[model samples]
Target: MALRMNVQARLDHRFAATYNRFMAAAERRWAYESRGQLLSGLTGRVLEVGAGTGVNIPHYKNADHVVLVEPWPAMRSQLHQKVARDARVATTVVDAVVEDLPFPGASFDAVVCTFVLCSVEDSYAALAEIQRVLRPGGTLAFLEHVRGGWLASRVQDLLTPVIRRFAAGCHPNRDTEGDIERAGFTVLQSETLKPLPVVPWFAPFVKGAASPADHP
Candidate 1:
């Protein structure tokens, strides 16, 4: 299916600082808690999509080999710091986005995605690509922000225009979990809960393995 998410090139050179600060502030509070849960669930030959600055570094305990994707050039400086001199997550970075993923099909045992679908140009397609590349029964774990209650949903809809402009394509209200379902995976377990501070809406997530593969 052709997706409408590639609306424009929102990843430009101008909003780098704004994105950096926004993410740095987001990390300490609610995000840290949510991300901690997601990372702990990851295991075995994990492939992390959109691993910005390797923020998921410390939580990468289950992995002996971890591959990450981060295409943005602007975030690389901060990302390097997260890479660290001896980080726990032994990381190899992929300089590309989801749609143009560089790995072969059925190449991963697991995939990690956190707070990433909203900014993706075509998140549904990206999920399909993830499902395509992962071995059947491979785990797909995510912690993302998406459309929620009617009140916050309305606010997210209204703010999306301006939010996308200033926040380097971050969207407050994309129905990310819905798209994951459509991509041919069964959600093994999920939870919907709110993060702290002023951030509105619930953080709905799915951490599950897919269907069994057809063997020849």
Candidate 2:
């Protein structure tokens, strides 16, 4: 079991190192636009969880300061490189997981998550942390691929085991929207889309903003 865990960690490291290259085509096709829309108008101190390779860095136009949280070493290395190259936004990279964020309560003005909640060990725990760190009336912006139609959902379920091993723990059929709502966030605006025509199983993408139900 220990040996198997080590091998899985090694595979995850490799996936982190090459994640940007694997998603480059998809980013150009539709992800960039979707990310820009999700992050638009966000300002003040912002926190982005699971900021893989800093793909959303260039789209941040109004943020005063950005904190990027990535737990994986290889992914953080690439994220640091991206931050170094981009001077448009003031940014800091922190090594932390979503479930256990090392920050004070109500520390950030806005929190962002892009393709993150799907892969977390505990989605509810992660969301709780996100809510704890966000100030009153603060926004939570997200872009996630979620469970789709009947056939697509079955395909996601069948492939998740293999995909989770090699794709850095991604579960393509998560009901992330429902998870967010259940975590006390009131959906402000949301849109669902089938971004990848070739990848039917990757459909039903959800992008939107929400605020804490009690605060809002």
Which candidate gets the maximum TM-score versus the true structure? 2
Report the C-alpha displacement of residue 113, candidate 1, in angstroms.
0.9
lDDT agreement of model 1 with the native: 0.71
Instruction: lDDT for model 2, please.
Output: 0.90
Model 1 C-alpha lDDT per residue in residues 34-67, reported as the tens digit of each score: 6777777666788888877667777887787888
lDDT of 2 by residue, 117-174 (tens): 9889889999999999999999999999898788989999998888889988988888
Clashing pairs in 1: 53-79
The Cα RMSD of model 2 versus the native structure comes to 1.1
Candidate maximizing lDDT: 2
